[model samples]
Target chain A: MPDSAFAEIRNLDLFAQMTDENFAALMRGAYVQNFPAQIDLISEGDPSDFLHVVLSGSVDLFSTWNGRDTSLATVRPIATFILAATVKDAPYLMSARTLEKSRIALIPSQDVRAIFDVDGNFARAVVTELAQSYRTVVKSQKDLKLRTSLERLANYVLRQQKRSGEVSSFFLECEKRRLASVLGMTPENLSRAFKGLVPYGVQVEGTRVTILDQGELERFAKPNPLIDDTSV
Target chain B: MPDSAFAEIRNLDLFAQMTDENFAALMRGAYVQNFPAQIDLISEGDPSDFLHVVLSGSVDLFSTWNGRDTSLATVRPIATFILAATVKDAPYLMSARTLEKSRIALIPSQDVRAIFDVDGNFARAVVTELAQSYRTVVKSQKDLKLRTSLERLANYVLRQQKRSGEVSSFFLECEKRRLASVLGMTPENLSRAFKGLVPYGVQVEGTRVTILDQGELERFAKPNPLIDDTSV
Candidate 1:
């Protein structure tokens, strides 16, 4: 890896605590690559050979069954995906694809496990990262089980709005179809969900969303931190 | 904790590899108790002060939103739940309750973190456990998003049957109402879902489930290991 890329990764929480020698050992067999948009990086059920770190652009983590595909999550810059699979030496549960031209660092899973066995700092960081990942998924499962599609979309808008500097208006993060899958709704239902939120002062045109009334939408969505807040 | 209880917990993978002294330190502030059925053990959004281990019986991990309640998972004997919350020192994301008369061990979260900072084996075990958990949740989310209620029920029955030592007949593990919530469907819908599987030879008599035709059900359920096999 180049110095600049190495420095960027070193700054990430997962790597920040690791010793320089161990970090170098982990990066020894790793390589950085750039892929065009819509490229498949890894497939579900494949051996988790590499731990992927997205340095730029975005990746969509998705799964398919019975002729249906759903987006499980989207990985953005300065984040790692498939670490759980890598650590467990298990098959990847979700396939990842590039959402746009992107740069990613691939570390061999063996190295991660090898270092984890010997490095306390890396092991602690891994535990923290996995714990965070586990909580995020639990929160997501709660969202899927306890809310209606409209309620999900409303909360999603609020979350995205918060991500975008708490702005009143901002562009949606991904395509509507992918968003629909992530929210566990059909595209038609997503459209109707947006329409359903109109009463709460949410307006959508193309990918742009304007929350005219945050309080009104909050009342309708009833966003709970335990369910919607990933940061916590 | 009693010596017998310590031995049982020591045999668990999470604690088996730690030094005896470190294990003793963890157990110093820990205590075990028995709770009656339907007793709430932990509430969502409260500080995750204890790492709970179910010594016997079962506990339900669930969430609620806007008056709607859903079952997230059931933790049966000889395993831990809410470790993510405990390690993160974050609020409990799911409320836990005993589904039956249960014995539980509560270890102080601080002790878990303190020992985790020192024990490589325990930290690695935590990684392994959390990775397994992360994959299980991903599989479940895929089950919810990619399959209909009927498909989920079919796959669920197949899974339960496997759990029953590949028997053709066994009782459902939990109440139908809880099963419905766990499958993300209404109780009425769950009833209809069971009926929908009749053509494939699934018979439900109260909680008694008899699979008259395993091949037919697996054909319908597709039973992808990626989604259904928690062991993997």
Candidate 2:
């Protein structure tokens, strides 16, 4: 096993409560792979085999409809994606691809299900992780339904910036066009929406965005717990 | 304990795995009560003390904003509601009330959590239930976002009819106004949409809607698995 891969297991929430013996058994069958930027990690409608955990760099998780694709979310280092799919043994709702050179911990879904059956703590952990993911998706729905296109964009900017602390500007983790689709707008409309936010103190330069007026932007965005917080 | 109360235990997914001894110990503190229609069993923003299971009739789950209420979902017999809040020990997201004379099982959250710490199989069962509930909510979000208002209502009717079987007609379960709110539309708009579907062979008579054209409605709704499947 790679040294970095062991470190990655220490960081996954699903394995957090696991005993070392249990976790080691988990890593016994697990393997880590490094993918170059733009490599397709998993595709939508494909059978899910492994739960991918991002250890470094970023991966864009997205879905396509009627020949158009939209970003579902971006996975950052130390974050695990696809627990729900793995637990339920369901097909991937969105495809994942590396947005940058990335290292991911690929744990087989069968092992996950097996350990979950035999290990009590691991099962509880799985439950919590799946529940949180489920809530995040629900909030995303409320967002798309309750808010307009411009409102979603404004709030999306606020959420991205808030994650980085006091940073006034940060680069978007996913493609600008994909982010537009996730926000439920056409790329053209998304471009226009970005221009409209200029008055609300949002400045977009390529993939990098600067929030000039956090207060004003938040006021306009009104990020509700049901819409923004995935921790519910 | 009432004979009927034990029957409710069979309905809960969490209690499905408990041994007779474990199940009895867990339910030592449980109680069953019946409420008349329109009784508010739990209110939003209130403490979640017990996991409520519906045994008979229906319960409407909804939220109120600025004195305006929106129906979120309806709970029927043999299913659990508010496990998310109960597990987190958080405030209720939406208020739950009886839609008809209803029987409910209330298991103290403390007992559930206590038994959870000791029973491995029970813990796994709870986790599975929570995870499943969470995914159901996510699917609800996908439905609201991916489908139009007309499509949402149309699919919702089909879902309701499917759940109730090939019955020619069924009750709405909630007020038309609440149903409208749940569908994310004004009562006027829902009424108008109902009228618009006349050519599609829909018949709405107050709270009783009969579908004469299931084929046409499904064609228009185009229910996706991500949106339509409750277990997703």
Candidate 3:
């Protein structure tokens, strides 16, 4: 592992509360690897033997059902995926794949469980992380259940814009197909959803989106913090 | 609090791992209350001041947007609700209401947080609980996104049947309207969806459901463990 990688892992909110001794012990069993885009990192039903942390680039978490797949979420750098599976010693519920050339640290799940048992700080940090993750998934479910496809798209664009520094316009970081899956809609429906948003003061040109009227869009989307807030 | 209520609270999985002194301390700050059916216990966006544990009967966790409400899940006896919000000290995302005459124990969120910080076993238990909750929500989201309304209803019936001891027929636990909301459909759509399921050998008589052909329904629903399994 690079020195910078260790520093980066040490600084993550998940690890910040961990004691130095426990963090060092965890690092001892950890290894870093780089993978090309589209490489499968983990598959659903596989035993979660490692707690995979993305150090650079990103990974897409998706699930398959009856030969059909849907995008769940994307894990960016300085974050961990599948921690719940690792912590519970259960099979992975979702498969992960590199979205680009990415670097990830694989920490042995056994080490994680062991340290979690004996390290108070580490255990507390894990609790906080798991709690936040649980709330996030709950919010996502509410968003999906309460909003229509067009409304979901409108709010998603607004969220993306906010994430990109609250500009009136922003570029989509992922493909339209992936966005459609994430929003729980067909690609064709997503295209129509974009057109549907046009009257609500949204304009899409290729990967870029401009919010022509924030007030009208907000009125149409009715974004609720309980459903839309990503922060813990 | 009644002696039975205290005994029930002590036996909960969330309290099982807590140290006796910590558990006692928690109980010292806790109180039990009885509520009539349809009484709202907590509202969305309200501060999570207490960790509510159902001792008897049940509570329906639900959300609302734009004058529409949807059921999220039903919390039965020996289970805690909104732990993620309590642990994170965040607002409750879903409002909870008593489904029947219910008894609930409310432990101050501050005491829970304080004890969690000092009790390693309790911390580990919280992690396990939170992780399980996170996966359950993820599975629900996947089920909603991947399956058609009819398919969702089909699988939901199968899961409920299994929960009712794999019987060929069982009574629907909640009202049809509440079940419809939980399944992310209107009562009218649910009625239509039940008709759609008849070709696969499902028959509903008022509150009772009979699965005459499990094979046909399973084939149609195509239940996957990643989406259907509830056990942690």
> TM-score winner among the candidates?
1
Which consecutive 10 residues in model 2 chain A have the weakest lDDT in total? A63-72
Please give the distance, in angstroms, between residue B39's alpha carbon in candidate 3 and its true position after superposition.
Answer: 0.3
> What order do candidates take by DockQ, descending?
1, 3, 2
- Backbone clashes in model 2, listed as residue pairs: none
**Number of the top DockQ candidate:** 1
What fraction of native interface contacts does model 2 preserve? Answer: 0.30
**Top lDDT hit:** 1
lDDT of 1 at B82: 92
Kindly report the TM-score of the first chain in candidate 2.
Answer: 0.90
Worst 10 residues of 2 chain B by lDDT: B63-72
Model 2 CA deviation exceeding 4 Å by range: A64-70, A167-171, A195-215, A225-227, A230-232, B43-47, B64-69, B167-171, B207-214
Q: Candidate 1 lDDT, tens digit per residue, B1-232?
A: 8887888899999999999999999999999999999999999999989999999999999988899899999999899999999889999999999999999999999999999988988998898888888888988999998999999999999999988999999999889999999999999999999999999999989899999998898899999999999787
Model 3 interface CAPRI class: high
Better of 1 and 3 by DockQ: 1
lDDT of 3 by residue, A70-145 (tens): 9999999889999999999999999999999999999999999989889988888988888888888888888888
Clashing pairs in 3: none
Candidate achieving higher DockQ, 1 or 2: 1
